[model samples]
Target chain A: MAVSDEQARDELGERLRKFVGRPAAVAGAGKDPVNAPMIRHWCEALGDTHPAYTGPDAIAPPTMLQVWTMGGLSGHPGRTGAYEELLGLLDAAGCTAVVATDCEQEYPRPLRPGDEVTFDTVIEEVSGRKTTRLGTGYFITTRTEVRVAGEPAGVHRFRVLKYAPAPHRPHEPRQQRRGPELHEPRRHQEPESRRRQEPAPSKPLRPRPVINRDNAGFWQGVAERRLLIQRCTACGTLRHPWLPGCNACGGLGWDTVEASGEGTVYSYVVVHHPPAPGFDPPYAVALVELAEGVRMVGNVVGVPYDEVRIGLPVRAGFRRVDEELTLPVFQALSSVTAVER
Target chain B: MRAGERLEPLEIPVTRTLIVAGAIASRDYQDVHHDPELARRKGAPDVFMNILTTNGLVGRYVTDHFGPKAVLRKVAIRLGAPNYPGDTMVLTGTVEEVDGDTAVVRVVGANGLGDHVTGTVTVTVPGANPEATP
Candidate 1:
């Protein structure tokens, strides 16, 4: 199966070009998965023991090489996953581009564990930014195909978007623009001129687990079904939990309040199997944007064991994971997805 | 002066330049961490920092502060930015919260522009004497 830009748009951002074109050759593809830990993890996680993944000998995990299989960086000092190229494509084109917004993956065939993978990627569609009261955003769809021993293993679909000038209604007032102050320089330029010219070089949050303060309030609210975000009073930026100051504006004071919990499926993954101890398979991890402009990553639950779709309208439901922690899980508002593919 | 009291900014600050080798030590090879080509390609603006350096830097910050007596138990890092070569980052931690033998530190690093790493750290000494009792 092959995909192109036009084909992807028709399928609502499916079929990427990078993953197109089979090697046109295959050999000993079915006998590889006998002895691989990564593959075994996938099998245990998905609980899928297809023959290709569990033949005579053990094979690597189907998604085992994900960490090791990052392909060559095709540009200047590549970051992770050709991220620069992806972001650059959007930064130059879209006013505000976000990454990993709507990510979906599925396996058409099983990959043997020991079989080496040849990954290819393609672009599907680049949607214009959609505006909200906070700012405008857009979507970029990509397709990736994973091959082992030149055989199809799985397909990955990703949708990235960034909102600039947030997609507000035409009737919305200019003062209520979703983007930073109009007086500021170009979105990309403002940061370059600032002291923290680049996103603060990721330093260790600490030598140990320092609380992600930004999510403190959200975590605190997790105990309550009241999902809350830190709203900066100075610049009106909506941030999750609390931080010393705003990422957008250097504000110290913040107000924590409940989130509407009504949001679309921004990004999601079907964890075929558990990654650690005490985790069950057939669960979903998703990033949902509540009505209040902030995005939260939590488990997406309650759909039929299968059938979790993109753009699904979901609401927040909290489950206590620890005495002081309540995890946020999303259940479908209705069986129907907001914008069915 | 009380032990572990906040140190004021000395007029003449103590600074050292650490030359970190770029050889692969950990299993982590995220391209941006070691490969300059991969890093520049990924849109990092530049290679700025990694979890490993941050780990070492935190030890340096505390070792310098505690003079070998401040026992360190925990240091956590959630990588936010990429650390590249020829970059010197400053590690700074503040005693944000202090409890009975335990102290919670709010730590961050900067290349002078602003913070690159941000997180809290908790360190305990062998025998921490408190100022007041319960």
Candidate 2:
């Protein structure tokens, strides 16, 4: 068998960028006109109760621009042959696995109920062959323009990495001796100190919070060692994280309410791989439903990641990891000792 | 505005809570954004940031600059590198063109690794830039 030529691979990488700027989807209309059911499902799934998405003056969330353009289970109408060919080319080059990496949206006007939506997507840019943790691949970016009744309403930029899956590394005998997942969750106990023992991280720190006008107040409450959720002044609805307007009533008036710090883990994931800087791998992160009836995501401490289960009782606590950063975390309370609340 | 006007950079600190909260807010259930062990198996060095969080941040960056009234017509951004927790990302923008209330601006968000997000945004600010007035 002959080894593949490296130069030929480089040429394939160059060929991808040429497809940029070509229209990938042309004049595709959404199957369903924008309506209440879809909007309700979306907000419910995200746990967003902002009042703007309901009632007579309802507007869809701006972050949902791509949702309106989704082809759904049936698939999209405007997908062109060229887009297929582009994927085929990459597949032939051994880049078959794909994962959505990021997306961007710009809204000129909010989408309203009963609006008929149409959109077109262009193959905006294709990157050079780049190596990522998953494998070597190119980044394909598509720009979509969404229109409501022939008027431009929003634009969405979506990108994905289509890569050849990374080869699995043979495990050390010690690692092989243990069960795949059971041994991992314990390592999160001493994250920062353990990080000091590992080799230097090749990547930068993880992305941070984007504090702005709508959400800055929430962070300030965290700094002051309090858990705050937004409460609608008009309808008495309590919301978590925070939003500019109430989705329940479309009320602009809101005030902050302190939480009781006790909650239950609604769902959780015991992360096992991808050890990171300053954090021990195999940690558990949970979506906790606060006593206030709003959910927030945070790390679950005081137990092995594997011990964190759905419905586990937890209490909020502040962990000042460093002088610059303090996070709101939850400590898993032992279920064996306490009676059900 | 001509091509050279720059928007002030916003400095943001990445925290574990930020990464997890942003992921949930966007309805992304991917473990890589919240769980370290799963992320390791997927080949990430640590639980890394997700693209949705970056998209939301970029949207906030533009709106924060244009004030509350400005409307974004288009935001086309590309992700370059992974943003891990414990790092800072600085977002900055420059106006590229202005025509009749619509202005095109180039935005770049740089973290410790390199550029995290780079894109162009088209926005309409009713009465801000002199050149945008017809």
Candidate 3:
């Protein structure tokens, strides 16, 4: 006699319970010691210029805690059979698809260059079978304790759902599979009647800047075709993308200084996919370091996206994208122009 | 930091290079973050940003406002809309509470689809008090 589905679920839940508190990984070591190269790569990729993440006494970005613990493409040597066995059971039970749900991390101490990293993970919990938008599945959570030279540094809690695909409607197209099950469907779907009443526009306007009180003056400057950098009244320090208080001296009083429009491409990335409104694909967005010693983000004009490079001299210019929008852009200066400068 | 104080918004263009670069940099070799064809097979319209990269971006947004002296103590986030390449994610923050040197900031990153990430970050900024300044 075949067991009832409810009985099968209960049996599976019981087996899953035993897996909890079991070691997922034992004494896993980082593939590489925390070093400048990896930190630099992370910084460049994220466009993070925090001085704390660099220099002789640099501490790794706190968010980098998990990066050091990842097993990478080759996988980690310390992973135990119990974790795999648990996953195999779930797969055999028809919960094959997986999606990371959420993560929680705490950094007790900062990671620094040359720190030897090691970690151990344990299966913290496995939830009972449940139904979600994706399908019926279980949520498996693991907690990892990361250390530097035998001292506690951080803790990471990662959770993922192993679910079988939800049943599709018979008439629905099979190729019309949904995006990542983790993300919600678009929030601004138009009503079918309204959408039919007025056809959608051909091109989308550029996303408007969120002009709040702190940055309103900067946008005002842009309207006047001036790139303004904030100057601290007390410390005379210059800051870009204006903030409420001075970071250098924590001063509240500040004024604006018009940029000289001279800068260099500190870093850049070429956008290629998913297609935003009002812009063509394969364009360069650069972090331009102004001569005033502050970096600002803008589009790189007068050059192909691929040609934009670090340290390339550029001049700031304003582009009126629409009636109410004027943006600061950078014009890459040719070698001849750089020589003239 | 005072409660209800808002941080300036930061706009980040989601680019394919950023997606691939961030995945590799964070040691997350997920194919959906790089291989578009594979991503399509997995039902994603195109390659999308990984959660690690989103976490890094959120961390940077907070630190950039608090300056180099600031340190992040905790960051807990939940993903929503996918950050596909060629889109934009605008990160906004509000200081929800403050005690001594540590402040809890509520950060929301919204893309074309909607809120991509919503979470709170605990950051400690040395000498963050504006009133104490002369």
DockQ of each: 0.01, 0.10, 0.21
Model 2 deviation from native, Cα RMSD in Å: 23.1
Residue B18 lDDT, candidate 1, scale 0-100: 22
lDDT of 1 by residue, B1-134 (tens): 23345633211111211212211221223443554443333334343333433443443354456443454444543333233344445566677666666676655555433344555555654456556454
lDDT of 2 at A101: 58
Docking class of 1: incorrect
Q: After superposition, how far is residue A163 of candidate 3 from its true place, in Å?
A: 2.1
- TM per prediction: 0.30, 0.48, 0.63
**After superposition, candidate 3 runs with Cα above 4 Å error:** A1-10, A167-341, B130-134
lDDT of 3 by residue, A206-323 (tens): 8999999999999888766568999999999999879999999999999999998889999899999978877767789999999999999999865557778999987776654543
Q: How many collisions per candidate?
A: 77, 23, 0
lDDT of 1 by residue, A62-103 (tens): 233222233222211212234333343223222222323333
lDDT of each: 0.44, 0.68, 0.78
Task: Write candidate 3's Cα lDDT for B57-123 as tens digits.
Answer: 9999999999978999999988766788888999999999998778999999988777888889999
**By lDDT, who's the top model here?**
3
Clashing pairs in 3: none
Candidate by candidate, in order, the iRMS in Å equals 15.6, 11.7, 9.8
Model 2 chain B worst lDDT window (10 residues): B22-31
